[model samples]
Target chain A: MARIEINQSLCKGCALCTLLCPEELIKIGNQINENGYFYAVFTENGSCKGCALCAKICPDVAIEVWK
Target chain B: MSEKKIFSRPKTLKDAPFHFCPGCHHGIAHRMVAEAIDKYSLREKTIGVASVGCSVFLYDYFDVDVIEAPHGRAAAVATGVKRARKDKIVFSYQGDGDLASIGIAETVHTANRGENITIIFINNTVYGMTGGQLAPTTLLGQKTTTSPYGRDFMQDGYPIRMTEILATLEGTAFAARVAFTTPKNINMAKKAIEKAFQFQKEEMGFTFVEILSACPTNWGLNSIDSMKRVEEEMIPYFPLGIFKERKAADVL
Candidate 1:
């Protein structure tokens, strides 16, 4: 199993991770972060493959993954 | 079960949020450089030289000691820093306008002199901090604040390939151009940065890593589209690869 955490306040909601996630588990959430951007969130439960594609492509270093 | 942490903020980076515009790749580049410093355990001895342009605040982001250099003079300042303290690991973070336009002479001479320093060059094709003026790396026909009619080769000349040019000099130990538009590219870029830092640590000649970064605010495009532009447009002109590498024997 893989665990994912996103620093919501630091996320810029660029959605590059959303587009890069192989499992499509990441998505841009409706709730706005403190920076006024719609940050990305893990949507599907237990679907994370821990590929870390999202974390790798996150320009802001907003995403973290543990496997 | 307590999950082991696989990814998190690098120790060399500060906790404060980045001030870069949304979708800008400076944050990624900064994180990579910080990670490299952490990997080598150079946090205590590393001295970063921050140059002008969008990345002028580089000192605030990195945890190590950093000095601000005037526009296009980061190489000169870094030279002085490295010379003063040979025990310290020194690196410079500069933009295209600072490195290739106004500071090209300093950049060339520093590299030619074989300074044991690493240079992280951000090539966004435009002057990002000053409202998107044309830069030395701006592609032909690219539109910018100064080049409203588009960059005409006849009028503006050609986009200068600094990495390729620096590769020809005898002083360069390692020179490569990398992009950060995708996960694979980011990984490659990280490897390149690590190698560059390793070379500096070994006291090899000058090392340069040119990262093709995204500037959505300056490019007048959305984040995703700006990233696409890097792949579809910029890659054709810049061509990512190691332009030069010095073997152990070559360094001696």
Candidate 2:
């Protein structure tokens, strides 16, 4: 099993993570974070492969992945 | 089953969050350098020469010892530091405006003199910190704050390909141009950066890596579109590849 955690406060809502996640488990939420950006959030689906593509593409370095 | 962490922030990076603009490539570039330093166990002896511009605060982001240099003089300062302390791994993180414009003479001379140092050049095509001014690497017909009518070849000479130019110098041991818009490209870029550092560790001559980065805010594009620009617009002008890799045997 694999999972990912995104530090919402550190995210700047670039959406690069949402685009790079091969499993498509990450998304930009409607509500903005403390930084006034829509921050990325994991959908928590059981399909995440923990490839860390999202973490790699993320300019904010806000994602942490575990498997 | 026990959980294992697959990915996290690099140890070389400080706990403070980055102050770069949203979607900036500086963050990714920083991570690449930090990871390379960690892999080589050079964190303790690395000295980073921070250049002026958007990345001026590199001292704050990277945990390694960093010295701020005057505008466009990072390569010159790095030369002094490396000469004074040969045991330290010295590097200079510079932007297009810093490396290709005012600092061009120093950059060329440093590499030509065979200084054993690493240079991380970020070519985002515009002066990001100065509100989108025309840079030496700016593409033809690309509009900037100063070049409102698009960059005319006659008015502003052609874009300078620093990597290719430096690769021609005998002193340069490694020179490559890379972009991290995709996972495959990012992987390649990481390898190239690590190789640059590795070459330096082996006491090879000057090493250089020019990264085609994005300036979303300055380019008037959104984050995703700016990254796409790096792929479609920038890569065409500045092809990605290892232009030169000199073997120590060749020098002998």
Candidate 3:
């Protein structure tokens, strides 16, 4: 199974990926990053399926989803 | 290279009773945007920011979700909406006064941040909403309410070339100025707009489309006269074409 990793510092908490993902795989995490902004991280159900849905939904062009 | 002429424009535009005056370039610009969204299949996901000045009614014009911002705040509002809903294609429609004058700060910062959004700036030289007062892009020696005689360079300074100004910023990924002066120029503007949108889809950076539109009523010129002015006068001051372009290689 493929997983997702977010460069927390790069994430701007747009939540676009979290919203557009057909599967509830990504979400805003409780912790903040170096930028002091809330970042999305992986969880138990975090298998991304490599659909690139996360990448497609990012506005700042921040997310990079790989298989 | 030869390109394909896309299909006809959206039917929504065909609806009669257009609020705009005859020969106003806003009509063409609006269709261009809708055509681009249709070609890219972004209709359902696109959200537009309606700006101040004459184009404020953009919300009613476009067949998409539109949000309004205070004069010159469209970029910042668009940034927020785009950030919150990343899947949606976001763009801001602004006039010269709105974009180049009151909103210069937002415009510069948004381009610097490369927020993956499109800015459609209409530079018609004069402010259409409040009266034909001189705009930031108002041509030198052009008469306006503020400059009753003409825009004296000594007092008012020269017209701002927005695309040129934005192109100098390192954060700007794509910046181009286009005009709706003639059929030939319209085609060029279409290609430039396509390229601007493509940059965002490819995750390059920010994109701006500066259109030298015509404000016939505010300009104190009839349709033909304004069109001629756009072709003969405005083009000289605000020439068209891509000012800056960067491929993925340049970024990484």
Candidate 4:
């Protein structure tokens, strides 16, 4: 099992993670964040491979992965 | 089971949010440089020269001793700093407009002199800070504020390839061009930056890493489209690779 956490405050809703996630578990949420952007939310079904691709591509450095 | 944190913000970077545009790649380049600084434990002994342009806020994002240099004079300023404090690791963060256009003389001379320093050059084709003006590295047929009719070879000339040009100089120890269009490329960019710093640590000579970044707001495209443009348009003209790598210092 793997997990990833995204800091909503720092995310600018670029959606690069959603495009890069291999499992396609991350998506832009309907609810807008305080920063006025739709932040990405991970679908927590324990399918994350923890490859850290999203974290690597994130310009904001908002994603943190645990394996 | 104990969980391990795989990736997080680098310590050398300030906790404050980046002031770049929504889809700007300056944040990514800033993070890469910060990560490299943290990896080398250079926090205590590092000085960063902030150049003019979008990356001028480098001093604000990076938690290091930063000196503000006049437009395109980062290399010259960096040379003075490195010479004054020989023990400190010094680097300059410059954009294409600053490095290739206004500061070409300083940049080329610094590489020719083989000053023991590192330069992180960001090339995004247009001058992002100056309202998408034409830059020295702007691709042919690219439309900018100054070149709204598209850049003509006869008028604007060809886009200068800084990495390839710097590699030809004997004093340059390492010169590589990398882009962050993909995760794999982003990782490789990080490694290139680290390698440049490593060579500087060895007192080899001037090392330079040119990063092809995307400026979404300035390019009049969304974040994803701007990134795609880098892959489709920019990469073709500016091929990414190690242009030069000198293993040993040249005997003067």
Q: Among these predicted structures, which one has the highest TM-score?
A: 2
| Candidate 4 residue runs with Cα over 4 Å from true position | B249-252
Candidate 3 chain B, run of 10 with poorest lDDT: B3-12
DockQ of each: 0.79, 0.90, 0.01, 0.78
Q: How well is candidate 1 docked (DockQ)?
A: 0.79
lDDT of 3 by residue, B136-188 (tens): 88898888899999998888888889999899888788888887554466678
Model 1 Cα RMSD, 1 decimal: 1.0
- lDDT (Cα, tens digit) per residue for candidate 1, span B13-63: 898888988888899899999999999999999999999998899877889
The regions of model 1 sitting more than 4 angstroms off are none
Q: Which digits, one per residue and each the tens of the lDDT, describe model 4 over residues B194-238? A: 999999988999999999999998789988899899999999999
TM-score ranking, high to low: 2, 1, 4, 3
**DockQ score for model 2, please?**
0.90
Models 1 onward score TM values of 0.98, 0.99, 0.75, 0.97
Better of 1 and 3 by TM-score: 1
- Candidate lDDT scores, in order, read 0.92, 0.93, 0.76, 0.92
Give the per-residue lDDT digits (tens) of candidate 2, residues A15-65: 888888887788889989887888887888689888999989888789899
Candidate 3 lDDT tens digits, A1-67: 4555566665656454665566787788888877666777656454546665454334233445544
lDDT of 1 at B11: 94
Local error of candidate 4 at B148, Å?
1.3
User: When superposed on Cα atoms, how far off is each prediction in RMSD?
Assistant: 1.0, 0.8, 19.2, 1.2
Error in Å for residue B105 of model 3: 0.7
Q: Candidate 4 at A15: error in angstroms?
A: 1.1
Q: What is the TM-score of chain A alone in each candidate?
A: 0.93, 0.93, 0.78, 0.96
Give per-residue CA lDDT, model 2, range B16-53, as digits (tens).
88888889999999999999999999999999999999
